[model samples]
Target: MDMGIEINTRFGRLGINTTDALIDIKSRMPVVEARSKPPRVRIDTQHVQVSIDQKQCFAEVGLKPADVFAKEMAQKSRSKGLKAIADIARKGDTLARVDKNPNAIPALAKGVMGKRLDYTVAALPRSRPRVSFSGGVDINWDMGYVQLRAATSRPEITATRAGVDVYILQKAAVDIKYTRDGFDTTI
Candidate 1:
């Protein structure tokens, strides 16, 4: 099934033409051209409708970050988990030394709370504002959720026609048409 699995919950569909990838890259995407618009990232598209004013970079699943992390860590040996934790700590220390920012982790971790994981606005016409690194910070013990490997699309799409296959994944889609009409239900 071609479900809503595109990245950033896209605002428009990206039609992959028969042309070369470079040629397609040269062609600019249709922009909404609105001032103070929401963030938009162009991932490979599918048959899904996206509304404007969307937020967040990734969809928040029924699975919690803590739970997922624990499960993943559990799959590995105790020594592996310890090593991973050590690696994270080393990276943190490196950042602290280089940037001279004591509160680096605390400040950099304001990205992982919402279902949407991206936002964009014309900060300046000449200046291209971009957020390269964003993630959730450790609330208590300074843990971070990195490396997303969530399954997108269904198994049926990948299944062969000769045999019958069953997929037990949720039909997930992010509502892109976010509005600030808290009180007005005049739609």
Candidate 2:
């Protein structure tokens, strides 16, 4: 009852034709109160995008430093110790490609609007907080179904470099199919 087309942009993976693999992780944030306003705690919703990378099937998710988990790092000694699990995950193995361009700020949008384009990148790191790149997906079509033959991954970043880890890899995909509800030719 389920079918799908997959595109492995190397660093991250994309799923077409179905939405069975999407996941959302929510965390309780701290409560901020103003002198005259009521206290409201922040909430984080991390969207997990699955990717087919590396040699093994791996996952890539995130947690902010000020969130509940990070806030209780000292108290949740057991939870903090379990972070080793992520250490065991090879770079490209899990959850498709997480924040391909950790600093590149992949335009949140990817399309040629006539002669212009608009996009967004992952949120930048702040003084003491970070964000998870969960809802990182875009889609387009020429008419019918579109499948990716190649993978276009985001560029990873570091203090000394940008776009070093990710690049315009290659012709990640090739082919286009347009589905129609036309009558079948009787044999």
Candidate 3:
């Protein structure tokens, strides 16, 4: 006449405090049936941190040719203004056929060549000397200081029931350190 049963929730803490059972005098109840324990191997370890920063400076500027075109009068597409007056009337009389006005010289070559040409930079391209100084002064303040480290070790499960090899889960050894700050600047 012996029986035991004790279970705690949250998927843990279970103690039947077994004394082995066998009591069934026709149906007194105690045939033994209490086995619920197979879930215990929780290991979690993870830590990661990273930081990177790189700043560079160097410049030279001088550009001047501000014609940025715009003479207006650019209207060509009556089949290219009649194919440029039919190639200047087959190369012999187009000033609008000597001024009879077939739209006079393609309206003066679409007013001297179809306008709209831009280049406005005759005085604003000046940054030729900042010489590195954004955490790398003159080029070596940890030239873009970068550090990366990672660790995730704890996963080596080995188990054998009868061939003489109990159980083992040991694998934790991974440490890394890297740093590069300054002197390799190419902008």
On residues 27-96, what C-alpha lDDT tens digit does candidate 2 reach at each position?
A: 4444443333334444445467655332211111234335544656666776656764654453334324
Give the per-residue lDDT of model 3 (tens digit) for 11-66: 22333332333332222333443444344444444343333321111112322223
- Candidate 2 vs. true structure, TM-score: 0.11
Supply candidate 1's per-residue lDDT for 113: 43
List ranges where model 1 is wrong by over 4 Å: 1-74, 77-84, 98-103, 111-187
Native-referenced Cα lDDT, model 2: 0.42
In angstroms, how far off is 125's CA in candidate 3? 1.8
Model 1 earns a TM-score of: 0.15
The C-alpha lDDT values of all candidates are: 0.46, 0.42, 0.42
* Model 1 pairs in collision: 39-119, 39-120, 55-116, 56-116, 56-117, 56-118, 57-116, 57-117, 57-118
| Cα RMSD, model 1 | 60.4
Off by over 4 Å in 2: 1-35, 54-187
